[model samples]
Target: MSPRSGPPLDGAIDVHAHYVTPRLRAAMVDAGHAEPDGMPAIPDWSPESALADMDSLGVATALLSVSSPGVHFGSDADARRLARDVNTEGAEIAAARPDRFGLLASLPLPDVTGALAEVEHAFDALGADGITLHTHYDGKHLGHPEHEPLLSALDERAAVVVLHPTSPPCWEAVSAGLPRPLLEFPFETTRAVASLVLSGALERHPRIRFVVPHAGAALPVLADRIAAFSLISGGPPIDVAGALRGLHYDLAGFALPRQLPALLALADPDRLLYGSDLPFTPAPVARGLAEALAADATLTAEQQRSMRRGAAEALFPRFARPGPPGAAEPRPDDRSLRGDQR
Candidate 1:
């Protein structure tokens, strides 16, 4: 079938785009991840190709990140080296086209010390717009007490933390041999968010702006259920809906007809952001989804515009205005990056 077409996204900022450098690919392959996370293979990527895809999708800037399986395989030392290499490569990619690309650096998680060190380098030295974290690392979800130090550092910086889902610990038993992305990914996202809420991490790290991807996965549908049960379970006295409203959600995967509506029910409309999940989703498929979102009648034009660009501008104001010809846009100053709006 021919690809669907719609109005150009027109300066939209895609919050969930991905990148895989040669070093990262080689490392994954060496670690027996020739097929990372049970996928057929890692998608091919390059700066030129990414730029072409962005142009076709009308994305003025894409915040690039390394997707699941992350940098850690088993050894913390190896993971640290890989994380540094990939983050450096990502920073270089964004540096080449500051106006068209921004980076969300990866961390060697499940290794808190290494992660904290990388966080310092990624933000203070690399000028990363944010940090990309998986829902869990080494079977430990984001709310684990061990991650408190890392969380505290992020909170201090008011960092933008984008949560991408990885294969959950019980994938073998529960996945029925199917790829994790189909079912396990969203479930893992829900689990991680719940962990943060029940553990009081969300409350403690209020300054950290967390961006939940895949239209908040299963969180929207289960928000009320969680809130109702938390009281009985003696979990933190947090208002689930209010907590969701305070965080941002990205429309990256197939969000129409169900996910988007459910997410809107719990999340603030102004906190919605655009995400293309490119390379992994394939450019054509991502474009079709973007077209569908643009044409969805449920959202008013203003709402659509906000998802496309406005909300993201508030978070990454460096892209709000264009730079001079042949000049690279400056990295967002810490104050501008930590915009007043959540």
Candidate 2:
């Protein structure tokens, strides 16, 4: 296959991408949603706009998920409707750009029945690549009872659950002094991952694949604490770090060019994925991340290929096809399965 412009890497799949459809935008505007003050303005996104950005960034394909603060702001009925609409729209984009796009379906969380219904439609009916979820729903984390049904469904279907962080409950109440994305976003992602790891959620749903963004949040730094908590706290002592290595981590928002050691220390470079939190950060940031991953002396060429492309194939194989024979696979234990997300 021909290499994409600006990079010799083949099959670079952006595992974390957002597509804010017109339907979702209209619902948000009509509801007059009150979001965290420092929450960056939602950019206007459509399939065409997303494709152009990916092409320019040399991204061969992207697994599209809903942007943060998804339909949860609306009433239960409105939330359900918006979820269906956006999911359908996402599928349409994937159909149009078979080689360039795939969808991570959105759902109205905490509404157990609605979430289940959407899952069936998005996964069984629409054929989505996976499911996208916010770290919390109105401050209720993943371990909450309300999420059990959704988790059960994903586990049963072996779905790929892409976890995105949103400002926790009442973030707007104290948004004046803090940078929401800069600090709160990663923290929330970290908090959710830790909760899932410690609360037996990961154990309960071993088949469920989670792709954590922002360089796996602070997970690499806190691996020891999590491991200790697992042992001392009487939670599962089942190798928290190893379990984390089994999970997928995407390199988005890690643009400093100096964060390589921190990322490499947590998991092998192969576990790292290529993601552009586009429309939030510029395309250059994505390119810079690709460059940084290449320059990290700790990562070998084979490992860098996994970070840039192979891991994404593991995360969403329906969308991210593997490269030619004998190419390095992301993980030895990792297996690609046919699954869907609702």
Choose the strongest candidate by lDDT: 1
Model 1, 1-342: lDDT tens per residue? 334453357668999999999999998899898877788999999999998898788787899999988999899999999999999989887877777789999999899999999999999889999999999988999999999999999999999999999999888899998889999999999999998888889999999999999999999889999898888886547777777789999999999989898888898788899999989999999888888887797678778877887788878877675542212233343345332321
TM-score of 2: 0.86
For model 2, how does the per-residue alpha-carbon lDDT over 128-228 read when each residue is reduced to its tens digit? 98998888986788867678888999999999988999877766665556757877788788888887877778888889988888887888778888787
TM-score winner = 1
Candidate 1 residue spans exceeding 4 A from truth: 1-7, 322-342
lDDT of 2 at 128: 91
Cα lDDT, all candidates: 0.87, 0.75
Model 2 stretches astray by more than 4 angstroms: 1-10, 33-37, 173-176, 234-238, 255-258, 320-342
